[model samples]
Target: MKLINLISPSANLAELTALASDDDLLLLRQDAVYLVYQAALPFPGKVLALESDINWRNITLPAHIRAITDAEWVTLSANASQNLLWS
Candidate 1:
């Protein structure tokens, strides 16, 4: 199944990255957006950030990570077969 993982906490990226499978889609939100600047790329799958959260944080997003809208977030949630929330 295609899984969409919502990771909102600043910590746990490394552990989650190691645990995540290729079919998982990881979307980092809240404090997790800060990982874009660090070495925490959350690779092995599609890694995205919530644009609203990024704007609220006033963070300058790196070119590598794509930001998704609230509507898009809902769409992604609806499209996924299952969801894994890691906060």
Candidate 2:
């Protein structure tokens, strides 16, 4: 599946949803971690956030979103069909 790295909260989510497929993975990092505050994510796929970023920002994430480490990020990128950066 595709692994999309979203780095900014200001990025167009509509564009993201359009680009992502149902089997894709969405990973929020940096300022994009703030997007977790939304009631629901538009993408119809798995969602993850950087664990360190979440801790640094002091934000609590919902159960649906998994918090991942830097090592896990590397693993996901290595396994994904494509790694996209949306900043």
* Per-residue lDDT of 3 in model 2: 99
RMSD of 2: 0.7
Quote model 2's TM-score: 0.96
Per-candidate Cα lDDT values, in order, are: 0.76, 0.96
Worst 10 residues of 2 by lDDT: 36-45
| Candidate whose TM-score is highest | 2
TM-score of each: 0.80, 0.96
Provide C-alpha RMSD values for all models, in order. 2.1, 0.7
Error of 1 at 21 (Å): 2.3
Model 2, 1-87: lDDT tens per residue? 999999999998899999999999999999999999999989988999999999999999999999999999999999999999999
Residue range 6-84, candidate 1, lDDT tens digits: 5555556678778777877788787777777776575688788899989998988777778999999888888888777
